[model samples]
Structures are given as C-alpha cells and as structure tokens.
Target: MMGESNRTTEIPCEFYSDKYPDPSNHPITIVLFTLLYTFVFLISFAGNMGVIYATIRHRSLQTVQNIFIVNLAISGVILACLSIPLTPVTHIAKQWFFGSLLCRVVGGTQAIGTFIGTFSLCAIAVDRYFRLVIAPGRPLRKVNAMRITMIMWAVSIVVTLPYVYHMNLMKYSPKHGLCGWFCTEKWPSPFSKRAYTIFVLVIQFLIPFSIMTVCYHAIFSFLRKRAKTRLTSIAQQANLLYVLAATAGRETQQHKEQMTHLLDQKKRVVAQKRRVTLILVSMVFIFGITSLPHNFVSTLMEFTDSRDLLTFYKTDYTYIVSLLTHLVGNEPDTTVAPFASLQPLHSFVNRYHSAVIPCANFETVFIWYINEYSGQFSSLAMLSCVTNPLLYAFLNPEFRELVLNGLAGVSWANNFVSKSWHPTQTTVL
Candidate 1:
C-alpha cells in the first residue's frame, strides 16, 4: 500500500486517478462537451465546404478575395475534421489512444490549419488595403492571390514540420491503472522547447496579428476619410442644384431630381462600405481575443518554471484564502471535536495532504492547473474554426448568396429520390 501510494504521488499530472476526479468524466460534462464539439464540427465542415463548392462551381465567385476566403475555409475544414473531434476525447479520457504516426499527423495538421488561417486573414486584410487605399481601380489578380495562398500553405507546412518531429506518443502508469498513454512534444532540450514555443507564438500569432491590425486600421481610416469627402461633395452638389432651381424652372427641377438620386446612391454605397469594414474589424478582433489565451498559456509554460508559479500561488494570501474556502467552506464545524477546537483545522490539513500534496508536487500542481483549466481556454481557440466560416464566408453578401443558391440546387437529388420512392398520380380523377 505504501509503495502504491508513493508511486501514485510520482505520477504526472497529465494522467488522472480516483484521488483526482476527472471533471470530463462527469455525465453532464461529457454530454455538453460532446454536443459542443459536434456542433462546431458540423457547422465548420458544412459552412467551409459550401464556400469551397460555391467557388468551384461559379467562375464569377473566383475573385482574388474569394480565393483567400476559400483558403481560410480549407483551413477551417481541416481543423474541424482533424483537431476538434479528437481533442476532447484526449482530455476526457486522459490518454492518447491513437498511435505514434497519428500523433504526429494530427499535431502537424492542426498547426498547419492554424497557420494557414492566420496567414490567410492577414493576406485578405493586406489585399483589401491595397485595393481600397493604395489603388482603387487596380485590384489584385486572381493568379496573384493563388500564388500567395500557395506560399502561405508551403510556409505553414515547413514551420509545422518541427512540431511534428517533436511530437511523440509515450506510455505511462497512472495511479490504480495498469498503463496509460499520452501524446505530447518531447523536445531535445529545455532550450529547444522554449525556442519552438517562442517561434510559433511570434510567427503564427503575434506577427500575423500585428499585420492584420495595421492593415485593417488603415483600411478603416481610409474608408472614413473617403466617406466624409464624398458626403461633403454630395452636399455641395445639392446646394448648387438648389441655387440653380430659380433660374431655370423645369430643367433645374430635372437636374435636382438627378442630384437627389445620386446623393441617395452615394449614401447607400457609404453605408455598405461601413458595414463591410465593421465585419472585417470584428473578424480581426475575435481572432485576437480567441487566440490570445492559448498563446499566453503556452508562452507562460515555456518561459516560466512551474516551481515559480507554484511559489506564487502558495504565497499569495488571497489565493490561499480562496482555495481554503473552496476546499472546506466559509465556516468549519466546531462540534466535530468540542474539546479540541483545532481539530477541524487539523482535518483540513490532513485532507489537503491526502487530496493535493500527494497527488500534486509543485510541478504536478502547476501542470494539473494547466491541464484542467487551460484546456477550457484551448476549446475557445478551436472555436475560432467555427467563427471563421460565419465571419468570413456566411456574413459576406456575395458568398452567402452563392452558398444559398448551391444548397437550393441540391434539392434535385431529393426530388429524384422522392419521385423514385413515391410515383406521382396523373389521372383525370
């Protein structure tokens, strides 16, 4: 028993046992997580596939911007198919059932998807900025967009190779378990891990995020200035028409009507432009917000030692108080030992030792905290896959129309099936 308990204390935080309840194992949690993952998968897969299908079927939809949109959709589809489904399973089961090859494949695919998505967003922003602000009449060519997308894919794959190389499936024994397995990166050294984490964080997230922010900010500024100038010009034209109305009666009235129509058209154009800009800005904002938590946690884990974090958590009196309240309650039962009022405190210490101390050394506590809590945040990051389709494809008027039309056309198959199953009656009755 002593040997078993000692071994249990030595077990890594990644594996769970009876002493540490696996929250993911709860019936309610399992149901909710399953539902959420399924919802994200279906939406992402169907939405992105629709975008790709629409672009392929209709040549008109194959513009430069649509090209990048298609790329983004491809990335979303990849993540939906590969990453999201398996992620929750690993967390819930506290094991990696997939073998060594799949561990690398899945990890590589996820990294590729993330990089492609981020790069595509940046590319779209830069393309839009150039089209609107740099040269209004000269838009990016479809060929150029295709080249850019291919470059993004190549770069994403190249950068992700290192991660795939480091990824490994290793087996371990959890408390009360014969054997368990997990998939994780086993870097050559601490410095290598830190370097890779920093590299990925900066290249995949920070740089692309910075680029998108700058481009979109400039685009918004340009649109606002352009709208103001156009509105001013329209007002001036209206005043001129009003002034000329007195000199030439019938002809001036006709001219004023034309000016009114033109003014309305300009207003509509400005409003449309503002809406598009707002949607694009929201996409960037959402991307940053969703991705930040994952990146921050990764960086913290890489750069900071677990011992440091444990020390901080331990020394922070507020944290201790909150933890105690959470573990015990606001008040303890003095009646448990009437003669020894400190019995409750002693019990609390014993419970803490049995529950936490044995299962959680400083490093174990830190890893457990991350595995338990940060996994929730990681789900938020995956949710960006679902949001990409909504923000980039479904929300865009042209893309939405094309997708709807394509879906409407798919009813032919249903019609044929219905005809075959239930023959129509065309009698005079």
Candidate 2:
C-alpha cells in the first residue's frame, strides 16, 4: 500500500489547477473522506466529553478559568465537526451542494468558528496570566468578558454577510475546464470584492492575531516575575519550616517523610505539562502560519481586479497544500539545504563526521520519540489535555469534587457497557 501511494509523487499542479479536486462527486472518495472525518470527530468528541464529564461531576471543577476552557473545547469541537468533512469536498470537486444562500451561511459559520477559536484562546491566556502567573486574587468582570466575546462574534458574523452577497455557485471558468460552485461576481450590487479582501485579512485574522501576540507577551512577563517570587517563597518558607521542625515534638516525624523535597527541585512532576503549554500554543501557531497563504488566495478572488492574484494563487496553492500536509501527517523534507554558512565539508560534518541534518533531523527524531513514547507516557504526557480540567478543580474545590464524582460515575457506566457487551449473541434456530 505504501509503495502504491508513493507512486503519486507529483504535488498539486497549481493552486487554482485541478489537483485533487472535489471528492463529493466521487462515490469512493466521498465515503473515505466522510469516514475519516467521522472518526476524527468521534475521537475529539470522546476526549472533550470526558473533560466535560469530569468537570460536571466534580463540583470543585467549576472555576472561571475552567469555564473559559469549556468554552474553548466547545468551539474547537464545533469547528472539527463542521470543517473536517467540508474541506475535502471543497478541494476535490469545488462543488458546493448548498447554493449561494448556503454558501453565505457557510461563510458565516466559518467566520464564527474562526472568531470563537481565536478569541477563546486569547481569553484562556488572559485568565491563566492573571490566575496562575500573577495570582491576582481579584476576579475580572464576567460582564466585560461576555461583552468582548459577543463583540468578536458579532463582528465575525457581520464580516461573513458580504460572502452571502458575493458567493454564487457557478461552473468554473470555461477556460479552466472545471465545473463546480465558485464564489464569483454574481451579486455585485451590495458587495465589492476589494472590501471583502480587506475585511477578511484585517478583521478576521490580523486583529485577533495581534491581540493573541500581546496576550502571550504579557503572560510571559508575568510568568518570569512570578517564577522568581514563587521560588524565593518556596525556598525561604521551606527553610524556616525545617528549622522550626527540627526542634519540635513527635508530630514533626510524620511531616518529615512527605515534605522533605530537595531545595533545587523546583519542578513538581504532576504539574510538568503546564510547562509544555507553551509548546501547545505553537499548535495554534501552525494553523495560522500554514493557513495564511490560503487566506491570501481567497482574498484575491474576493477583492482587487488583479488576475495576477491567480498567478500568485497557483504559487501559493502548493504552499497551502504543503501546510495542510503537516496536519494530515504527509510531511515533505522541508529542509533540502545545510544549516550554517560553514564549508561544504565543514568540520561538524567532516572531522568527527556524522552527517546529521540540523533542526529538521532533530525534529524528525523528536517526532519519532514522541510517537513511540506517547502511549507508554500517556498518563504523564496526556495530562496536558487535562490541565484545564485540573485547573478547574484547583480553582474551585467544590466544582472539582463534583466533576471528579461525575467522571467516576461516567467511567463506571462505561465499564458496565463493556461488561454487558462481552457476551456475544447466538444465532436464532
């Protein structure tokens, strides 16, 4: 199968060209994409369900921060549910089953999804910065948060309104020879493509991204300061407690065994994934970095009288395809060149010469190690997935207990199902 797949080594011919084309028209391709999407949806559903279950069951899990997390997960799941299926079809046949009205609706939903996903992330960053890093005891106004979120959604929805007017399901260019639904100059009275071009780039992405960047910078600043404060407090307090306990009575013996952590051991193993949250933020990053060109191609179609956008569109198509490849695990060797301006047979490669590619090689090694170890380290590493859920528990002890209890009940129910299903049905005579 691998060898058969490897035979198709040609990249997409061009962005606007028929590479894979829409798959919905193909019985087999539609079925495959549908099944793949359904599977991804189910896994994400189960993962997020477990989270919600735990949070609801454990009363202590109802922290404000967890509320935002729940919102984030909900939005992401909605995105996954809506998007994964549509993507392949749009790519394959370029036929949109739903007409212009539906096209506009899709445009609206896409905007909403984009808005929610990004804003939710920014919200989490702010909440974490205040709650964890600064340890600010005061709560921000929930009303304000709702207002901000509502505004973002409203803006996104409004931005998509033009797509309704602009999107006309049409056959592809007679010149291009592909017949599929295309968003074109059908409804030009109310909507201008240039206006849309500017709006999508400016409102949908640029603004939200700028805010996210600022939020992260502020978070890092708070983190650095808080780390120092926490380390000092932990050190001084531990020492004072130790000095006092040394001269104390029999109760000190019980305390000695459990809390005798070394002074230099600043990290707690249980909370290690919090440190990796920084890396997870990069996942959101890959989405944007990869998606930027596609957004540009779409923009050109919407605005500007430039047929040149088509030229760049084809150039950018390969880039967008490359970016999407990463998401689906179809990686290309992105690095075909050497690192550094060192001589062709530089000392690093020649002297003690192991011909190691630099970042790309290490990244490949890292990916392999992660894949190999992920299952074995599931309890340790996958804990990051639960970090928000745990934070909910920590922040609100009542919610924590409630969520934990609910999750326990759900687990028990699942176990019962497994047991009940174990017995196979005999064929009737």
Q: Against the true structure, whose TM-score is highest?
A: 1
Which lDDT tens digits does candidate 2 get at residues 1-429?
888786675333222225333222356745765676566556555555655666555555555555566665554455444444454444343335556665555544544554555566667667655654455677656676666667757765665555444334443332323333343223333234344445555754576567666665665555556556767776776777677777684447555653466343355421322543443355345435534533443343233223222124333232233213312421011110111101110010011111122223433322221211111110111112223333322233344334444546566544433332211101000
Clashes of 1: 0
- Tens digit of lDDT per residue, candidate 1, span 347-420? 11111111112222444533433322221222344556666777776665555666776788675534433232
lDDT (C-alpha) at residue 208 in model 2: 58
| Model 2: CA > 4 A from native | 1-35, 48-63, 130-135, 172-192, 233-259, 262-265, 269-429
Q: Quick one: how many clashes does candidate 2 have? A: 30
Q: Where's the lowest-lDDT run of ten residues in candidate 1? A: 333-342
TM-score of 2: 0.56
RMSD (Å) per prediction: 13.4, 17.2
